[model samples]
Target: MSEYHIPVLLQPSVEALVTDPNGTYADFTFGGGGHSRAIIEKLDKGRLFAFDQDQDAAEQAAKINFEGFTFIKSNFRFAKRYLKVYGVTALDGILADLGVSSHQFDEAERGFSIRFDAPLDMRMDREQPVSAADIIANYDATALHKMLGRYGEVTNAKTLAEGIVSARARKPIQTIADLLAVLEKFAPRFREYKYYAQVFQALRIEVNDEMGALRDMLHQAAELLKPGGRLVVLSYHSLEDRLVKNFINKGKFEGEVEKDIYGNDIKPFKALNRQVIEPSEEEIKMNNRARSAKMRVAVKI
Candidate 1:
């Protein structure tokens, strides 16, 4: 067992996705094959198409003994394409555990963790052109400041952006350590680490175009699922959770969970549970990264 990513809410999320007996399933983010393993175990001739952009995750998946599995080597945004290619227009359920895997953070060369001293490259798909270093070095002050504010939730986003612009101009902030050093300059000593994590998060979001990709993926999900199908989402951050919650409950990001002429809530999905399901305390203890996980399940109605 690699033990890098313990797979957050592995039981709850899998149970949500595979509740329908032998239904067609798609694990859009098959990081360690944990959920995939559970889903496959539930299937009897139930075709499951797994998607993982990371080549490492795909290679790791090949080692698993599973039936009714097909690996798609593409971003989950391309899920619609892959499903059509597989001749699966409608799926019984879709599960997405979005964001970077613990494996990516543990591998120092991947540069996803703040504890690492590696190049500032945080691309989920290595083929992507924009990288963390590129975002830090190239984004103008205003643009960088906006990213820092929105994605990182940094209090001193303006100062942080200025710091990066000034430092990169003098000598490019090319590594994770470089970014931290610059962040430490502006961030108070007590809050330095917290602030830096936010700044790095902002850069990574911009580098990966995470928001854009997420919006696209969500749209794909809404369209791909048949009426009354299941949509289960695991989001690590508020930005993602808000979108999922809004879309499922309201059927529109900004619109109120829609209402019918008679005042009944008009929605494509109805909340299966009122409260967000979190990883058990035990799971969080076993995998520290699971602390932030939130799982939500909705049924297409």
Candidate 2:
């Protein structure tokens, strides 16, 4: 097993919530329990409910000895339902460190990182039917085009989708290597395969319906929060970050500053901060995975 994922923005995010020591909190992605451990240190009477869909996360969950910690083996999209099982109708604060854990990327078979040569399977939940290979093999050209365009922001989405269709006629694209071979047709001249990584990220997002899950979790988190509750989200990609920023500021992703028909602002949230927070240079120097992280925080009004 590879070293577990190091939690990004660990201190800053926890400090945001732990400021209110007695308030109940939730960590939506409890991989390796780093943030949860910090939250436990702050709480005296408050309890924490954590969620991680991956079975690998459960092993790390076992190591947490903190009292009043409930680690659920499920995804955050189902968080509302699971929290209900624990009788948590509302939370005082919520934090979601979204995207694959470093543990998932480093572990070769999990296939989250382009650094490791492994199967192209990038299911955050491994039991799920959809996998990167399945997307490559089954998705039609139009679907692939929109996936690359919407998620990856690739310029040549249509051409790239066509390339997959053409290449897959000869053999099933079953691994990252196979996908890379197909992707090379449009690979841009760049620094260290960043483009390839972006394309692979787009595919992984589509395969797992990650955006769909994120949308659900965001809406649910909003509903599950008590007035004055804090919502802090760490997003590694632009699309995720945009959704979070808009939800915090405008209360919607459509980019319209939501208001009553009379132009009175109608929002359940007060933007705690307009600028996104990033990892310190020292933090990124220690963990390169922190390079792309952007954290946004909102307080329920």
- The model with the greatest TM-score is 2
Q: TM per model?
A: 0.95, 0.96
Write model 1 residue lDDT over 168-285, tens digit each, in one string. 8788888988888887788877987777777777777777777777778778887887777788889888988888888877887886666778998866788897999888888878
What is the C-alpha lDDT profile of model 2 across 1-301, one tens digit per residue? 1267788988999987765777778999988888898899999888889898889888888888767888999989999998998888999999999867878877888877777778889898889888888888998999999999999998888999999998999998988788887777788866438778879889888877888888898889889999889888999999999888877777777758867889977777887766889999999998898999999888888
Q: How far is candidate 2 from the true structure (C-alpha RMSD, Å)?
A: 1.7
The lDDT for every candidate, in the order shown, is 0.82, 0.86
Show pairs that collide, candidate 2. Answer: none
Q: After superposition, how far is residue 270 of candidate 2 from its true place, in Å?
A: 1.0
* Local error of candidate 1 at residue 204 (angstroms): 1.7
- Model 1 local distance difference test score: 0.82
True-vs-predicted CA distance for residue 175, candidate 2, Å: 0.9
